[model samples]
Target chain A: MEFSKPIKISRRHVLKMGVMGSAALSLGIFRSQLVKSKTGSAAGSVAAQKTEQIGFMYDQQKCVACRVCQAACKATNNWEEGTEWRRVLTSDKSKAYLSISCNHCEKPACVEVCPVGAYTKREKDGIVIHDAEKCIGCKYCMYACPYHAPQFSDDTGRISKCHFCYERQDNGEDPACVANCPTNALTYGKLAELREAQGGVDQLEGLPNPELTKPSWVIIPKKE
Target chain B: MHWHWMIIIYLFLGGLGAGAYLTSFAAEKGWLGRNSSLRRTGYFIAAPIVAIGTVLLVFDLGQGLTKPWLLIGLLANLSSVMTWGVYILAAFIIVGLLKGYFTLTNKSAPNILTLSGAVLALATGTYTGLLLAVIKAVPFWATWIMPVLFVASALSTGLSLTALLAPLVEKKSFCEGREGRAHILLIVVELIIVAAFVGIMISGVNGPVAKESVALVISGVYALVFWGYFIGLGLLFPLVVYIYRYQRSKVPVIQYVSESPSATSDLAANEQKGHHSYLTIVSDISVIIGGFALRALVILAAIPVWDGITIL
Candidate 1:
């Protein structure tokens, strides 16, 4: 199918113009840097030291489908009654329950789709959080999330979902959902350590829902 | 199934419809007299409609309202349509207000201002359809033809509104010559686009999403809105009216000269033509209302409920 000329022009022209404009602006900065170097002064400061890394690890086999985590999420966040930031989905036929929340991916779709920069991923920990104040409640994030994790609150009109308990983690405590899990199914630790401990899912086990968004969780096969 | 999406869709369609009509109206009226009484009325009416529509969109976003600044400040994602839409609509409101102000002051408006506003209005009017079309996941909305159909709907609705309001604001009588004919032609085009869009949607239902969307639009809850309003009243009825008028206008005149062979006949040709023009204006109003209804229905029906569906 033949595409319109205007589409091609707009796409190419906008990009070219943007690059040219940036190059000119950066040239000015580069000349100023050279002047600063002549004066024997550093143009920039050193990067900050790395902080503690925070993330989640879910043991699917240990999850009894009791959903205490879901309850704990609501209680901790004081979210509206019907809103569930953390949802527990169980396949009765397979006797497996999966607790799904925001994966806080290296690249988050919610952050990408938000019209207003209401959604953000922390560079330090890769934790995605919503700033309700900036939220226009467009709900584009809901469609973008492969996990279907984000939930819109009717009372607030803004998108509300799990923040992985950033506050609790800041205080050196596990997330409410992970802390309250009875069977130790949920774990919170450094992302690298969790990856090393569980070794990622290699094959389908106990009705694994492959369609689930690349969750940060590790699934251990349930023992018969 | 959230009502907020419905509100967002309504605001988008209404603002675009109002903005496009105002732009076309201003363009038709010379730039010098852009703030004339007719233009003033159009802008005055349109500004509030768009402003109120935007407010409705904000209200739909919900309460916590923490990061309202994200829209303007940090969260402007150029890649996403929603982000662009927010910025475009925001620009529309700003430029529209400035245009209104300049008109009130009886000053010559800037060409760039009017042109940019028109372009933004056009983008705002059409992007909603494109937003849905880009989503490969939703079969019903994934079509190259959707954006063109949206543009047609926008023009149809915009023209309909101007036609409906013209008699009240402009001194021109409803039943007259050129303007009436243009209105009729626009409605005809709008009807054709809607037909093509629906045709494509129904014919391509190989996937589950496609089948579900088609079912929803044709036989499900959307049927009343699509068929009852968009198809039945919006397109079909307007086509019948335009055709009937065209036929009457084209009919060969059968004049019978009785006693005096070459006597001057005062048949009042202009007066009869005026009557048909008035009918055309009424038809334009019907088509515009129907077009608006179609846009509203399409938006509400297109969004899927992402409750249990796992994203791969």
Candidate 2:
């Protein structure tokens, strides 16, 4: 009732707030987040059963970055010129390559951010998929994805990312990128088996920690 | 990057429109003032402003609409911010139009209806913040403080907008009252909260990305606009103007030594009051400008930290 009255600024209030802010900043709160960045990066969502969960294994030692997987993905998914869901992101001077897509993580950030529920992670196989019709092309998924996985098409105004070739997987075939790898660098299998084959490791020097979204992939570091 | 000028405009407009409803509710319920004109003016302005914001958001996301689904049958993504926004915006428009019509027809509405509208308005104000805050990968945006900051600014914008418009629309009862003081207070609150929001973000979670984003706005390419326009012109300038007006209003006038309580003296005093009331216009406009600049600059300066292709 008395809100119309003049507001008096309190010194004690200001001091308390100032102290709190200083403590938060001086404690290196931001830097602490970096140390905790990899906290849960090694594990998948616990609620989701690990049994028969679809996953991938990328043996960087065997990869040659031939551009064949890139071609195969474009041909299969029919991505336009200057668009390839499967990309060979390589280092300077042709050092090595890291191919990534919708990690199809157990906890997919893209699915959570899609306003219209356009992006979904399949319950059965744990494959993340994008629905063109449902999508408003908001591109929230682009920012939501750390991998830069979703590609926006100017023609359709919709984002299309790798669904990990769910259609092929449903037919008991490897995803295009895995199937067309020249040196047998890419492989697909059940999550448990892939992790066993990968020696149960998730961290790699160049790759982001899987704990962020618990990506269902196994990457074997190229032997130095 | 997707949160561009269009999104910023939408944010400003949405807050403006929703905030009007809140002010109206306060006026209608005798919170800010028992001025019925404040309520009527609020109802009148609410629908049209919100419509513009909602339309801009639709077009921005729809990519200028070749597809039919762009305008209709929005999904109820419970986890998504936009989903809540869609529903809230729709409710605000309906409530606003209905209230506007009721006020136009000179009919008093039930308290329940007005209260519901106010609640919807609050949601509308907060939803835009949540929309950005839910972006998990963008450390620059993923913060709980975002919604609080947005709501504060929205309320400030709403109060200022009401003060700004009351003079033009219903000058007799509303503009020359306690709303100016309230507007001044709200902007000051907004300024403090904005600083806190930045501090929280600067000290928030996520590694290099959040740090870079804070840096980007404070001292990076966005420094000029953020500091100069938003803080200087929008917050500080408006603050100075409004505080000066408030202080000036508090000091009793000498009546210009008329030595007689005549019609002309009364007229002179009224004329002075009118000019003082007009001062609200400057401060309100400053607040609105500051609000828009803040939203737009935040979006413009946001640098999404991409997970690097770190070659080892």
lDDT of all predictions, in order shown? 0.60, 0.71
Highest TM-score scorer: 2
The runs of at least 3 residues in candidate 1 whose Cα sits more than 4 Å from the true structure, single-residue gaps closed, are A1-60, A92-95, A136-138, A170-172, A187-224, B4-9, B12-45, B64-80, B97-108, B130-146, B172-207, B250-278, B303-305, B309-312
lDDT of 1 by residue, A1-224 (tens): 24356446544754775687456445534643453364233212224335334567777667888989988988899986456788777665666666777777655667766665567666456678887765666777776664566787766666778899988887988899989999998877776667676444512332223343334444454555
Output the TM-score of candidate 1: 0.71
DockQ of each: 0.20, 0.21
Q: Each candidate's TM vs. the true structure? A: 0.71, 0.83
Task: Give the native contact fraction of candidate 1.
Answer: 0.36
**Candidate 2 regions with alpha-carbon error over 4 angstroms:** A1-51, A198-200, A203-209, B34-37, B62-64, B70-73, B171-175, B253-278, B307-312
TM-score of chain B of 2: 0.87
